[model samples]
Target: MSMLSVLTSFAKRDFALAYRQRAELMQPLMFFVMVITLFPLAIGPSPEILQRVSGAVVWVAAILSLLLGMERMFRDDFMDGTLEQYTLSTTPLYAIVLVKVAVHWVVHIVPLLVLSPLLALFLNMSLPMYVALIATLLLGTPVISLIGAIGVALTVGLQRSGVLVALLLIPLFIPLLIFATSAIDSASLQLPYGFQLGIMAALALFTLAAAPAAIAYSLRVSQN
Candidate 1:
């Protein structure tokens, strides 16, 4: 098969497997919603306060939700020998990693995006705030998946690498979190957030270009 065919096949297989494990897949979405729900309860139903902090709340929930699913990204493949097969295949590992991360990002982030409107309503966000939130998420969530893939690949062989992955990844995520929240905050005040959005898009592009190679290297080293 051609490289595009191989990439598509791998992505479809991963999506099928993810569907079969739908319960596991829903955990992140559940956690994301519950966190957003709890914030109002904990902080009281003040529109002013909720709107003020909603961007940070959403961004944090997204990061944690993405983290919750990161472990499964490579664990099943590693255990079932699929990861090693990818390593040995004539197809470039970079393409394989790209497909895997893309599928993983779609599976995990789409639900969060679907739920964001409800979250915005609950938080009493302004229209601008909502748009900015969605924009940041669109550009940022994939970065989470790409960067998280590297951490997951690094620790795929370890029995309990969740904590290590979090440790390695959360720091990397701080800059994204800051940028996302800052954009939303600026939007809440009716200021231009295009600068922050551009920075986030640049970060996402850089990750898109660099992370596949890093993930492929990590997977190979872990398997050896």
Candidate 2:
């Protein structure tokens, strides 16, 4: 089969599986909304305070939510021997890994993106900051998925890997969190945030280029 055909086949399978297990799929998004919702109650309802810390709160919650779902990225495939078949297939493992991560990101993050407007309003984020928040999330969340895939690949063989995945990946995510929140903060001040957004874009591009191969290698090692 052509590479495009193979990738499309894999994507469809994943989406179908995600649809069947949608309750599990929605966990991350629900956690994201709950975390963002609790922030106002904990810190009081002052618009100034919410707006001031909104970027940090939202980005942090996003990272944690993504991590909550990261463990299962490769677990099912590994358990069912699909990963071993991929390793032995003529099609490259990296291509399969890329498709899996892309599907996971789409299945999980799209809901968060859709719900972001209401969450932003709840936090009293100004229009400029809200736009910047979306921009940063668009650029940064893929990087989170791509990099998190490597950690998940490494630990897919472990019975309890959720905490391990978080431990391994959260430090790497800190830089992204900083750049994203900084962009939002700049927008709040009515200043340009092109630089922070640029850095996030660069990180996204770099991970998109590099992470698939790293994840493929980790999967191969884990399957051995």
Candidate 3:
């Protein structure tokens, strides 16, 4: 089969398996909603304050929500020998790794993306802020998965690597979080947010180019 076919099949398989574990798949989305919902109660429902902090709230919640599932990104595949089989296959490991990250992103991030508008509503975000927020998320969340995949791959075999993965990833995720929230903040002021958006796009592209090889290598080293 061609590489495209292999990637598509692998993504579908992973997605199907993730769907079978419906409760686990729901955790990140639930966390994302709860955090967004609870923020106003904790901070009080002042529209002015909500508008000012909305971007930061969404971006922070997104990072934490994605982290909730990072541990599972490669653990099942590694534990069941699926990862070993892929590593040994003639297919390029980078393509396989990319597909795996993409699957995880879709499974974990899509629900959050769908619910973001409601969160925006809860935060009383302006239309422009909402637009920029969605734009950043569209460009940012996959980058999180792509970069987080490397950390997850590195620790997949460990007894308890969840916190370790978070530590390894939070620093790597800072630039993205900054760019994303900055874009939304700019939008709130009727300013052009394209610069921040462009930077985020560039970061996403860079991660796409670099992360698959890194993840593949990390997986190999971790399995050693």
* Candidate 2 lDDT tens digits, 1-224: 68899889999999999999999988888999999999999999999999999999999999999999989899998999888888998889999999999999999889999999999999999999999999999999999999999999999999998998899999999899989999999999999999999999999999999999999999988887
- Pairs that collide in candidate 2 are none
* Model 1, span 1-224: residue lDDT tens: 67788788898999999999999999989999999999999999889999999999999999998999899999999999988899999999988999989999889988888889998998899999999999999999999999999999999999999999999999999999999999999999999999999999999999999999999999999999
lDDT of 2 at 127: 97
Q: Estimated TM-score per prediction?
A: 0.99, 0.99, 0.98
Question: What is the Å distance of residue 115 in model 1 from its true position?
Answer: 1.0
lDDT, candidate 3, 1-224, per-residue tens: 67788788888899789989989988888998999999999999899999999999999999998999889988988889998899899888989988888888888878887888888999999999999998999999989999999999989889899999999999999999888988998999999989998999999999999999999999999989
Model 2 is weakest, by summed lDDT over 10 consecutive residues, at: 82-91
Range of the 10 consecutive residues with the lowest summed lDDT in candidate 1: 1-10
1 or 2, which is superior by lDDT? Answer: 2
Angstrom error at residue 211, model 2 = 0.5
Off by over 4 Å in 2: none
